[model samples]
Target: MPKALLTIESLVKNYGGGAVLNGIDLTVYEGEVLVILGPSGCGKSTLLRCINALEPIQAGTISLNGEPIRRDSKDLPRLRQKVGMVFQSYELFPHLSVLDNITLSPRKAQRRPRQEAEAEALALLDRVGLKDRAGDYPRQLSGGQKQRVAIVRALIMHPEVLLFDEVTAALDPEMVREVLDVILDLARQGRTMLIVTHEMQFARAVADRVVLLDEGRIVEEAPPEEFFDHPKTERAQRFLNTLTFETVKKKAKNQ
Candidate 1:
């Protein structure tokens, strides 16, 4: 059995007297890829942000390797180094070149030597087919290229667990596969990850286990094969129906 690398228990978050996440419980095992699926306003993005302390929790605890963490803790920065997140927006610094962008976190946040950070960043860029573009500014790269650099930026930190919050949601159709392929490559290498996305096809292709969330709670969790075909809850079934209908509409539009 795989060990649990990230653990969340009775997780809760509120927004202006309203609960966005209501008592959620989840565990991500080492080497596991968990894809969280939910409709709009279901708090999927909030959940990922909470883990990295980007969103403060109103209740419960998040732990990594069994040690509890909090937004107010002095160790937050140290804890965050092991948990990296990539957002839907490329969020790249427009003025920085790709090399500088990817190296910034390690060199500045972690205080690694510039030469050391650059070497690691270059290797990551090479893997993602962006080695030559290292000198190019964010404005000089395509949306896909900028996103690729964002992924490299997170990886350069050497995180233990990565969170992807709709990483491909901002990409064009043609660019989607490139980002997904990079994520798939990481998954195959046994990187533990939690992904929040509406891309059912990509989720099915990448998730070892899929979690269906509705109204801030997990309605079902199952292997991708099972979850896609045999969702256990009525809410999940309805959600799957919508996904299927959308897929059909997309295909019809293409033809």
Candidate 2:
């Protein structure tokens, strides 16, 4: 059996006065790609934010390697280093070059030698086909390139678990595949990742397991083949059907 790297139990999160995530129980195993699929406003993004302690929970616990993640604890900074997140916005510093944006945290926050940090950053950038763009500012790159840099920035932290929240959602149709290909490469390398995305074909291809969330709860969970080919719940069937319709419509328009 695979070891559980991150465990969430009875996880509850609230927004304003209502519960956005109600009694969620999930486990992310080491070296597995777990993809979360859901409709809009189903709390997929919130779940990731809560795991990163970017959002506070109303109840329950999130544990990494058996230790609770407390937002106010002094150890929080160290804990965060082990859980990297890449967002759709590509969160790179506008004024900094790609290399600076990626190396800053390691050089300043972790106190690694500047040379060592930049070396690792360049290697990661090269893997993502952006080594030549290292000297380029965020504004100089395309949407896909910026997103790849964001992934490189996250990987340079050497995090054990990576959270990707709709990482391809903001990209153009042509740019989407390049970013997804980079993530696919990471999955093949056995990186433990929790992804929230609407790219159905990519999800089916990359996920070891697929989790379907609805109304802030997991409605179905199964291996990718089983989940996509034989979803066991009505909610899951309907969700897939809607996406299938959308995909067909988009394809027809393109043709």
Candidate 3:
């Protein structure tokens, strides 16, 4: 069997007297790109947040490379470095330049030398076609540009696993491909990732495995082709039926 990079067992998270993640068990293997498919409010984003320790879990356990995640412990900072997350919003600091925003975590959290970090940062920016924008502020860049910077910042951390939470949802239809291209590049490098997205076409193209989550539980899991073409569960079938492939194709054609 492949080595597992992330493991969750009966995970549960509650918020304001309601359960957001209701008994989720998932395993992500090394160098695997696992795409999460689900309807809105089905705990997809919550699952990513919980895995990154941004949110607290009320039950169950999460282990990364065999180490249990402890929200109350000092180890969380280290854990977060190994599991970077990209959100729908770019979340770059408004006042900081793009270069500064990308280097802050490495400088503050990892305490790497400024020269080494900048060298790496520039290379990352270059790869994403934003080297010239290193000195530009977040507001100065477009949504696609900002999201690409967020992705580079996460990559500069060299996380063992990366999590993307519906990253294309906020972008204009035209800009979606630019962000998705960045993700596709990462997958090409064999980076281990767990992505929560509604972009089924992209998911189908890049995912090694696809998981269908509904009502806070996993209803099905399969390879991308199997999940999309022959879902094993009724919930998954309904979810796929609602995806509107024609609309997805139309958006692509428009771009």
Candidate 4:
């Protein structure tokens, strides 16, 4: 009840004859980390895209801090500045150095002075533990480092809400930890975040709420302990079972 930072009501997204997101509704409060978990192709990423207006919502409304982001609104550019997105692909410019990648948008999009934007970008890089890689290009950095740079780039916009679309999915097993560590740090700082992720451990450790999506619908949602321990829906139970079995089998092999 801290007054929702993000509100999605009756959200719908369709592609051709198939519905990618089916009448979804959810709210994210300030200073909370909300993890959206679901099987592949369940519209988790599409939902995030729709919220940020990267994908036009076929229907419903998405409001950030009480201002609605409708398809007809002329204020989308300003609205997008308040919502930052970090994708799984780490969509960095190969031609630019890490520092440039981080500062480019702020300098151009926000119309800030170059020096000011660079200073802010460096600070963000430092926060993400990438200060040493400032001059490195995307091709020179590891997957984890590139993703970190992407996060810093998004943060440079000073967004009010952050949307992460399975940021660790493409990272190597070892690299995933580094990215998750940074995300956990962000959560500790009370950043309002909505993440689509498969990492149940990260969700259990950092998320204030867990929303389970299945075939474009929210199947269940609750606190981590409640959702993981007592998943109510058949879809949630089956998903958890699959993950648990896979984890157990992997652990046994390792042992």
Better structure of 1 and 2 per lDDT: 2
Q: Which regions in candidate 3 have their CA more than 4 angstroms from the true location? A: 245-255
lDDT of 3 at 93: 89
User: Candidate 3 lDDT, tens digit per residue, 1-255?
Assistant: 889999999999999898888999999999999999899999999999999888989999999999998799789899989998999998998989999999999999999999999999999999999999999999999999999999999999999999999999999999999999999999999999999998989999989999988878888999999998888888887787677667678888999
lDDT of 1 by residue, 1-255 (tens): 889999999999999998999999999999999999999899999999999998888899999999787988998888999998999998998888889998888988899999999999989999999999999999998889889999999999899999999989888999999999999999999999999998899999999999988888989999999999888889999999886767788899999
Please list the C-alpha lDDT of all candidates, in the order they appear: 0.92, 0.94, 0.93, 0.92
Least lDDT summed over 10 consecutive residues: which range in candidate 1?
241-250
lDDT string for model 2 (111-170, tens) is 999999999999999999999999999999999999999999999989999999999999
lDDT of 4 at 109: 87
Clashing pairs in 3: none
Select the stronger candidate by TM-score from 2 and 4: 2
Clashes of 1: 0
TM-score of 2: 0.95
User: Whole-model lDDT for model 3 versus the true structure?
Assistant: 0.93
> Which consecutive 10 residues in model 3 have the weakest lDDT in total?
240-249
The per-prediction CA RMSD against the true structure, in angstroms, equals 3.2, 3.4, 4.2, 3.0
Ranking by lDDT: 2, 3, 1, 4
**Best candidate according to lDDT:** 2
Q: Model 4 lDDT vs. the true structure?
A: 0.92
